[model samples]
Target: MTAPASLRDHAYQTLKRRIVEVQLRPGARLVERDLAAELDVSRIPLREALRMLAAEGLVLLVPAKGALVATFSPADVRDLFDIREVLESLAARLAAERATPDTLAPLTHRMAEARTATVSGDLRRIAAANAAFHAEIIAMAANPLLSNVMGPLAARTEWLFRLTASRDPVEQCSEHEELYGHIASGAADEAATSAFAHIAAGRELSITLAEKWSDPDFDPELIARGRRRRRVES
Candidate 1:
């Protein structure tokens, strides 16, 4: 028989999922007492789980206020995007060179599904589809090093993509189509260039629109701390 999962493992995965799915936005408080009671586990396991997430850059610790989700300011947004640009450029280049027809087919399916999901405007499916698209490409790169490099950054990248999706989503989907074509044509450098620009544009849009999402409920402390990005509002 399979052994039961540990409490700390359960707590870690549940909390991580909640944060990545934006149920716990950046700077959203994680009240230990409330969470332990709600999760029906003792504080010990919950605290342990939180410590794990903190190491992963998903949760933040405070001297007195407990842990909250980590907030991204304009600088953080650009830095993360710059790193992804480097990593993804390499991934795209390698995928084009290394991907067989069998490998390419899966990525094509993933992108097509993502495009369909985007056209339908179902945010939940869009999130899943987007992950599938990126993951398929990452896998096609056939580099263990790329996956190792991305393991820690994956959660934050997903959060950033969700933020990007909230902005000019149609443009984002169209870029994915262009990327698909470039990769299909065996243009590694071209695909890399297009993917880099697409990702960079999304990152810029996320930072520029960051203030519009701030409110008392979403993240009061960050709302107070973040300078408005100054985009024209409709």
Candidate 2:
């Protein structure tokens, strides 16, 4: 049998999922005692998990009041996408200039996985596969410095992808395929352009959704309902 998960790991994963899915609303207080009881763990593991989430930028550790879910604003979305555009475009360019078919196999695999996930209407899987595809591109780019810079942002990027899950995953997969083709053909300029276009296409929509989700009065239940509706529609 598989080994049981550690309390800290379980708590971290559970809290992270709740936060990413908006079950734990942004700017809401996270009481240690309540969370500890809810998760059926002692305060030690709960606090450890909170610290981990804080490091990933999903939770804020206040000096006196305790932890709060991290908030996102439209400006924050734009800022993140701006950074992604520049860095990801450069990564695609480098990958195009350096990648071979073998080097790009991981991206191709991720693209296929994303397509399957989209068709199956698994939003979480789609986000994860899409993130993996990007990670592969960064790795294929062969720049350690770039990878190091991007490593910390992977979790945040996946979080953003989930918030914008209303977007057509099919279209996103298609764009990933196109970018892959450019990289495989060693067309550096085309690959860079494709990367920028892909990221830009989602930027405005993400900002709009962020505005709605970040509103103080917004209902978290709506996020779940929307995902269910999208699943049916897809």
Which candidate has the top score in lDDT?
Answer: 2
Q: Among all windows of ten consecutive residues in candidate 1, which has the lowest summed lDDT?
A: 225-234
lDDT of 1 by residue, 42-138 (tens): 8888888888888878888765546777776666777888888888888888888876788899998998898898889987668768767877778
Per-model TM-score on C-alpha atoms:
0.82, 0.84
* lDDT of model number 1: 0.75
In terms of TM-score, the best-performing candidate is 2
Candidate 2 residue-wise lDDT, 1-234, digit = tens: 222349889888988877776666666667776677777888888888888898888887766556777777788799899999999999999999998778878777877887788888988888888988898899999999999999878878888888888999989988998998999999999999999999999998999998887875644333322322111000
lDDT of 1 at 172: 71
Q: lDDT for every model?
A: 0.75, 0.82
Give the local distance difference test score of model 2.
0.82
Over 4 Å off in model 1, which ranges?
A: 1-6, 63-65, 212-234
Q: 75 in model 1: Cα distance from truth in Å?
A: 1.5
